[model samples]
Target: MVEPIGGASTGALVPPDDYFDVIKHICKKYDILLILDEVMTGMGRTGAMYAYEHWNIKADIIALSKGLTSGYFPVGAILTTDEIVDDMMEKGGFAHGHTLAGNPMGCAVALEVYNVIEDEGLVENSAKMGKLLIQGLNKLAKRYSIIGQVRGKGLLTAIEIVKPGTKKDIFPPEMDVNHLIADWAFKDGLILYPRRPINGLRGDHILIAPPLISDKAVIEELLELLDKTLARSMFMLG
Candidate 1:
């Protein structure tokens, strides 16, 4: 089956050239089709027109959602290379589609959203802000052992929480440290997304994804709220 192996959200990209190299290596070795999910990381969320552009790898197919209408409307789009399209057509259009596949209203809104991202320079702004956020988050990680890993590209990033004393002893099931921090951040006026697993036993991640319109001031505010919430949440110790 085909799946995306390497991608980034809005975050630091000091050496984007190297990151793409790893993605290329994996694609070659596995002989798998690279499907780029540009939902949160697309349409300038990464300061690039598309997150994959930063990696400089051409994707066989790209699934886009979320930012298409800038959250004003729900929409999705699929892009594929000419060869893939030809093959799919030869196979009877690939036999898949959604109810609103060609809804005019959604299309209109998505069109405008694309226009705005390009016209307002939001993509470039996201890239710049991503660097700032990565730097700040890295500092926070250094100060707090609760943080296990910080990685992302553009505006899409996640902070992994673990036990305070032992890196391997991640917060226990009863504690749900990811939810605790998410709740804490919400109470502090910074909304964050907590990753959830189907079994409710293996998920532990906090996603930091803000609107593309956010500026440095807003990003700083979010960072402060996140850092403070993480510091105060006691779930990690339990």
Candidate 2:
């Protein structure tokens, strides 16, 4: 079996470290290939060169995008072991190519983005501030009935919203509680992702992925607004 993985993904595993170890063991036993999806969590988004690197585990392939070019230009990469590359080349050079894939302008910009990330030490900063953000959210969860859980590593975190008084009953979209929170957050100058479940109205969560360059003060400001938004939105859901 070949498994597709994402860093700190909601459905994959929690705490990330454990997930890597567990998957590595499973792969060893089942002779499976691990394919990591690093689009959202790649290129220092999770305060590591690549999010998977933090786990000290290796994968057979990794699909990277999003922060790879810092959103300056559209581009993506398929990083894999030499065996995979050799096999594909033997089969006659990647059977796919996009007109814009090798654009020089995009390549140049992406290079600069990499340099900026390294020079400014944004990845390390992300690691530090991400911890602060998660800690703060956990504190907020202590006082709110609507917050079911706070889980994430680095700048990738999520706040799961559930019905205020129902132990395991999820929030219904008829209420759009996540939307209410997102709207409030936007007005507060902090844009966030209120994710949809694979199916409508099944999952309710606000995914938080701030810029890696954010500092403690910025995180505090964002969390302050987030906390306020949570409070007001939770009240509205009821």
Candidate with the greatest lDDT versus the true structure: 2
> Per-residue lDDT of 163-197 in model 1, one digit per residue for the tens?
76565566668877777788878888888877745
| lDDT (tens digit, per residue) of candidate 2 on 1-238 | 1223233335222444476678888988998888887877788877687877666788898887778899978878878999988998999978887777788887787788899999999899988998999999899888787888786777878888788766568865787777788998898888988865646565678888888889989999988988888778767775
lDDT of 1: 0.73
Off by over 4 Å in 1: 1-32, 90-98, 196-199, 234-238
> What are the lDDT scores of the predictions, listed in order?
0.73, 0.77
Error of 2 at 156 (Å): 0.8
Q: Residue 65 deviation, candidate 2, in Å? A: 0.8
| Winning model by TM-score | 2
